[model samples]
Target: MEISKQYAERGYAVIKKLLNQDEIEKITIIVDLIYDRWLNENGDALIEHQLINMHSLTHPRYFKNNKSERIKFFELIAPEQLTDLIEKMFGKGINFHNTQLFFNPYTNTKTPYWHRDLQYSLIEDSIQAQEQNNILSLHIRIPLIAEKGIELVPGTHKRWDSELERNVRLELNGHINSEKLPGGILIELEPRDILIFNAQMIHRGNYGLNKVRKALDLCIGKQHHLLSGFLDRDILPNDDEIRCISNNQWYVLAKDIADQNFAKEIEN
Candidate 1:
């Protein structure tokens, strides 16, 4: 299939049966090990943190320990056909920006609000800024387990408007009515299947009765160099200052009013 052309026109495409059982097992093992490690270190606190910061936690660069493992795993899979698909979408000379694992446990819970991946990045400055840099935000999701998958609004990526942005924020704040946004047209998949979409698309994590849905999510930027954004700089915090190292150059991080210390700073 001509995935690049399709993705260019439609903003998303699904590649069926990309991984064999053996490859799926390898990815499953790697993800399971990481999840175990996460539980060991943080216990239930990890889930609490996720619940408290679902929208912000989507930034993979902020996750350090998982970032290293993800980078290594991506390197192992870089030469595969998946990377070829990315090359077709973004052209040649592409490198890994960041990768993440989104595990939505199968339990009766509220569905995630519709939001764009670019909103979670440092590039969320202005509508004009988003238009200039939004194409760089490409996302690929590989379902590690079968049954549960994401729900997306097809062709929504191309409609660059302020209403979508406002809806995203309102949804995050639990103020928007679900019926107002696009709801159906879910992308369900079996194990090893992959779905690649533009990061600007309206999508939400859907967790049904399956109990646990694990997906290996990866993002690639336009530049060959690693991206320097809030996740790598502000949240991580280095040397008493938020710093981002890109192309071996250090840049000071921008202050975010949402930080935990923001309230304390105001009180003082």
Candidate 2:
């Protein structure tokens, strides 16, 4: 089946062997290092917050002055193999927003509950429902380990959530967010596979399916008013850093969009 067809019908799509073992190994090394650093620094906060994932894997702070590794990280994350895929699927002008590294919580090891990504944002729910198709928020999930990955509600990206979905996702009236929704699709993925899903679709991670979970998510999106300004400039390579790096299209586009959006703020 066509990737776009699967995406349109199911609000998600999976591509097989998108990264070879060697490629996966390089990414995992850095991811592992970053996770260790994060766990050391935020051990209490993460456990206290009960958060299972950490964002901004590219943030300079994580590299601990290891400029070479950080530069390598940026390049690896934007390989043409991935960028070309995104352009083909969603058309041009997509930009890197941030990154997320997912793992089971240290104490409870429970997966996050199902919910659409954007509802937690400041954008009103009514606007999100109205402009669902016009927006292009996506989570390009790349698992570093094989596992039963995520469960998503089909076609919910194009339509509002059902009442049952609303109750479960929002944990309304005693319904837990992790409560299983009817017809949810559990996408099993291997290390080399890629799962591209609508960020606004109802979904949750499947942490219990695997003992070790280290998935890297590239938060990519086309520039939209509703989603702009959330990007951090520090994640992009500096001018000197960008020159030596190959596969910088995503960062270039991200920096350009961030500049445009911030400029608009001053102008107004």
TM-score of each predicted structure versus truth: 0.68, 0.94
Which segments of model 2 are wrong by more than 4 Å?
109-111, 265-268
- Over the stretch 140-174, how does candidate 2's per-residue lDDT look in tens digits? 99999887867888889889878899899888989
- Return the top candidate by lDDT: 2
Residue 182 lDDT in model 2?
Answer: 94
Best by TM-score: 2
Please report how far candidate 2 places residue 127 from its true position, in Å. 1.5
> Clashing residue pairs, candidate 2?
none
Candidate 1 per-residue C-alpha lDDT over 1-268 given as tens digits, one digit per residue, 9 for 90 to 100: 5877777667778889877787777667766675665566655665554531122222344355565544344333343667656666677544344456776643344556666665665554375244743455667777777755677776666766456546564454455624345444677778767888877677777666457777777665554111323223232323332222322111121222123235555698
Question: Per-model C-alpha lDDT, please?
Answer: 0.55, 0.86
